[model samples]
Target: MSQDSTVVCVVCGGPAGEPVYASDRECSITSLCEVVPSPTVVRFCQACGHVQTTEMPGIEAYYDTQYKILIESEEEDQLYAMSNGQKVYRLDHQARTLLRKLTPSAAARILDYGSAKGGTLKRLLAERGDLRVHLFDVSAMYLPFWKAFLDEGRWATYRPPAAWRGTFDIITSFFSLEHVARPREMMAEIASLLKPGGTFYGIVPNTFTNIADFVVIDHVNHFSAASLAFLLRASGFGNIDIDEHAHTSAFVVTATAAVQQGTVAGIPRSEIARLGSEVERIAAYWRNFSSCVREFEDGRTGRPAAIYGSGFYGTFIASCLSRPLDIRCFVDQNPFRQGRRLLDRPIIAPEALPEEIGTVYVGLNPVLARAEIAKVACWSGRRLDHFLP
Candidate 1:
């Protein structure tokens, strides 16, 4: 991004719209990995209603080293893992949903791009035994799982551009495109990877649907429904359909590669402005959130406190707390993280929390924060304003 030239939208080659938020790069919530400190800049494009960061560093390194830590730990990272068995349920349900919409062929080639741990592909394989499934991901640490999950010679790491041109009937990416800085090029690559008239199904966070997604630093692309439609259409895709009901923060999309060039739908100015306003509103909410955290810590420095939800938000709260020793532990429901420690504090189950614990800051996503706190039987009817607000 040169000062002389305007930044272009990642989805559409439109003028970089408006700056919505600026701050230091936050810690990775998905992988719980440390990131190099840099100024974070989030902008929204008025032409396409796509929100993106202007500063995107080497993402490959982020995934290979920092992101791979979660894989090596055998916990699969919070990014891939879901709460309350929802990971399996979500994957199986999405696979079944997609299979229901498509006319399955006797021998269909399906590629799960960014197939972390090959879990999604595994479910798809079990459900559609006749399909030829393949996996692709940035982190090759999951390579070992492929042999057991898929047939031999079905997994791949980084490949040259268009290496498998026109080879698959379906190419799917779940929560992958938003991490890429060059989304337009990614769309083009997706188009090239699929056979003519092949379906490209993807799921990405809808920032408006879940405001917490708007704050995640790693998600460079904050796509609205309109922008996603534009991206697919601009990438020579047709018949784009979005299912917003699949996940709270996700948009499940199905599109087909066009045989020839086609026109794309442009977002209305009013809609783009509305999306930009949403960016502003989320930024304000976070500002108030940070302030509330600071106010709580100002005089209650010696209280025994813990953070609920050991994912990104919890990690972020821990980073903000001045008296780290006051933070006794982290409360998480993930069985894999129960006995583990994060940021030098033990991650305990809700039942394991000490009765003397003064405050338990809810670090879960905003959408689930209230409900998660309500589940703690020990804290029932307790004054939890300091913990949740």
Candidate 2:
């Protein structure tokens, strides 16, 4: 994709500046680590300081037909953390966060927008049985899972029913906004779906906090606090609150519907420059990441290795290596991914790793990758080498 000057910013109507980051490769991997012929080119809007990538061709069809996340099982969930020897899952954390932020009236209507499998709402309902919940998504693939907890009349696919407008007391979106190509239109739709003074609670990845999101090919929008504020205010939402530190690498936001749409103010030029410089720094880091992995592989050629973490980071490490076959398998803590195969290599528990593998490639988030690897007691005393990003 060319970095055309005429490319428009999704957040602000102004033309985007020059490309902040562009991939030389013709194909890129999705967050799920599936390879596709979509080169990434990220740009920032000088008008609003919003950083975003050009939408992938046929993105709508891609999500509707090809995008499947964590669908291996109904119990599948991302591991949030290991707290005192117990696993804290993503869905549990999301439900708790939402409940802590807002208290709904008895039997208040709630909708999960862009809900895939509706896992978070299912967990929420477990805590509050009195709530009336609904689910909506672009695809019908997850209807079977929704059928377990939701009535047939409570869920819709593709477009929501027109009668739903101005009926919901609370609308929630979890990790959905960043994937959208047109966020303004989505925010408008959410605004229209809510009752008067209804709440819109959602979460989006914070690129500043999670550096990995900056290069994820499927994440079209990299929202900053300033840009999120602009999106909500311009979309007829008031009482906006964006919490950056509430969740790791994500911004938890809550906004109330307003009677009149508010004007979006121009971002300061100095603030824009600051955000631009930070984006460039992150882009440079990723540019060097591939080379770092290749150099590591070159020195340890012919040695048996295993990649830890089967998500995007681990798949990226495999993509960088000239000899991917050297990797015997992948190690992950998530039970849902343990039996799966990435690059034809089986994913297994860390304890199930072969004894012959002397080196391990840590393909987790750079922020916590090293610490997580260090916590693996099974690898301790084995004199194994670990290459952490």
For each of the candidates, give the backbone clash count.
1, 0
Task: List ranges where model 1 is wrong by over 4 Å.
Answer: 1-5, 24-35, 73-90, 100-103, 160-163, 299-301, 381-386
Cα-based TM-score, every candidate: 0.89, 0.98
- In terms of TM-score, the best-performing candidate is 2
User: Model 2: which ten-residue window has the lowest total lDDT?
Assistant: 258-267
**Candidate with the greatest lDDT versus the true structure:** 2
Model 1, 156-239: lDDT tens digits are 887623557889899989778888888888888878888999999898988776766665667888888888988888889988
RMSD of 2: 1.2
lDDT of 2: 0.90
Q: What lDDT does each candidate get?
A: 0.74, 0.90
Q: Write the per-residue lDDT of candidate 2 for residues 110-166, one digit (tens) a residue.
A: 999999999999999999999999999999999999999988789999999999999
